[model samples]
Target: MNDSLPGYAERLDALHQALAADFRAIIARLPWREHESILDPGCGDGFFTGLLAERLPRGVAVGLDTSTAFLEAAEARLAEQIEAGRVRLVEGNVDRLPFDDATIDGVFSAHSMQSYPDLPHALREFRRVLRAGSTLAILETDNVHSIMLSWPPDLELAVRQAEHREIGDEDSYIGTYFPRFAPRLLAEAGFTDLQREYIFIERQPPVGEALERYVELYLKYLAEQTSGRLDAAATARLAEIGDPRSKRFLPRQANFFFGSLQTLITARA
Candidate 1:
């Protein structure tokens, strides 16, 4: 777990609890079965990995990530299960997963793959480590499209400016993040029986501690994105956007494209 991610972890935990029922409803439609070993790539802080371990059959869950901070946090959260030998955690990058070829039954990632510098290389690695008939599920935010749709005009401009100032590449992190044509990627990776689905998760306004944490995370993200070059004006504008008392309420709904999260049912020739 990166020290940077714990705050986001707290926010997501709040999200999981608040939306547990809805999340379960969505998971119910996923094709999971008993005793199938699953790999959670980029298993940040182990939240989703713990969820899968609890839901899937016993003794068949593994979490792999690059952040030592996250792996430590994940181990702590799943300590009891680890003691019982029901879960395993490994720290490694997705582009060079530390696993044997054709070993895993399935793979799952959420809101993490977009950070990879080389998407195609990482996708190829995903295809490499899975068994011939294994599956891979990826969950990522369509930040480009989603932000444009949901953010206030002023806030959106700030985000764009911040992007330009920082990366000099508008799509640096989010370019091709969602895999709009997931089947094409799967096909390129030699996957078959490809199916994709889009799920819209409506996030209500954050409240109390959760809201505070959310605002902080947003600010921190902007600060990092701008490399602290975010001027006083941009900082002030972001504060306004996050002000709980402001009339411009945060968008009540966030459309999270789930196709990337649900693709790759099995490998192919």
Candidate 2:
């Protein structure tokens, strides 16, 4: 996927507002002190990493991700902060983090865990890097299945069809239902003091440029799923269905799974 599209950065920035707010809420409840270190696994664009740096006093914040494109964007977005020696952006995968055991005080990841092929391996890595009693905060979207159900009947059917055509392989694109089983996974990873909280945000209807960008991305993903099987005529029909002019009849709803599940995990050496 092209991460450098013109409006992509802006759209991601808007989305990060909600993400950063949730992270702030999570941090507010935790007992943090000066000079502690935190890792943002899958820190796309480093928006939350910057937020963490601002909130922590004399602390080190690192943003890690597998995508070099995203890491570069993050570095650029956080250049001023980086030059000030507040944040670090590293290119790495979550399953194999580049950090010493017991080196970090906390791990925060959002919206990316669902794409991992081996979630348990990633969770183990998070467990291995944090000191004993360190906290981990994960925020991700629920299944596309759940999302489809929340839409209007006509729109839901359209989205479901698009998704069905898009899943080329079940093992390859195992979307975001991982959080539903997070409690069990945390226990398996030797984490204690587990808690889960669900956060729901009212959907703000996209307008003008935002709506245009949203529809374009949605159709782009849909096209990828169909893999050119959806010819021009079919594509045009889907576009008509997703038209913002009809948004009043088929409103878009955004539902995210924000888990404030905190657990004390053992660090490996």
Candidate 3:
């Protein structure tokens, strides 16, 4: 967790609530069997980790993350499953998994790869921990079509270009470029049977409370990330859209709608 982002946990929980349905849909797409051990890397609040446990009646779901705060929250959220031995939470990093080799039957990660400093190393670790023919599924943001705020084309482009330069292109938009590069990366890491799927979630007014809060917080986070990089007018516009008190608050607009695209890539180890 970034110390600067005080609301990181809150934002993650809100996002889980808002995208619950879409996330469940993506989980359903994973090739899970009833009695197979599954690993969920970067299982932030254990939202999807609990879901994965439910899918495996006899098997266990191991949720791993580097953040102790996140692991603590996951522990509480998944206490029942943990007590039942259906779930376990571990504090660890993706690039260096703690599990033994060829143990996990399947691995599922959601929107977590972008944070990793060395994605190739993490992918190799994922491959190392999986048994032969096990499946690995990852969900990443498609920044190009994600969080469309209805901004003018030029301003949007300018903001993106500036943000990319400010935060390195790979770190800023890994999801947008994943499809183009993931195939080779996975192949080199000893994964095969590569597949890709796109998941879309859109909301129109009157949006639910969860979606409304999610959009507001997400915009604010983006605004903060691209803070001094934008021109004065663009900065003010971003602040206004993210500010719930402002008349131009995006979610409250009469025609307000939100859409997101996430890419799900799966491979066999």
Task: Find the candidate with the highest lDDT and give its number.
Answer: 3
Kindly indicate the candidate among 1 and 3 with the higher lDDT.
3
lDDT of each: 0.63, 0.63, 0.82
C-alpha TM-score for every candidate: 0.74, 0.73, 0.90
Q: Candidate 1: minimum summed lDDT over ten consecutive residues — where? A: 256-265
State the RMSD for candidate 1: 5.0
User: Which residue ranges in model 1 land beyond 4 Å of their true spot?
Assistant: 1-24, 146-152, 161-176, 205-208, 223-235, 243-269
lDDT per residue for candidate 2 within 64-155, as digits (tens), equals: 97777778888888897788787888878876899989888888776666667887788889889988877787666565532321334554
Query: lDDT tens digits, residues 1-269, model 3?
Result: 45222367677788789888778877876788978999999898899899898889999999998878778888989999999999999988887899999999999988777677888888999999999998999887765666765655776787787666744565555534666678988999899999988777787788778877887887778778888888999887777777878888888888787777888899999
Give me candidate 2's TM-score against the actual structure: 0.73
Error of 3 at 8 (Å): 2.8
Model 2 spans > 4 angstroms off: 1-14, 17-31, 145-152, 164-175, 205-212, 223-237, 241-269
Error of 1 at 117 (Å): 3.0
Error of 1 at 209 (Å): 3.9
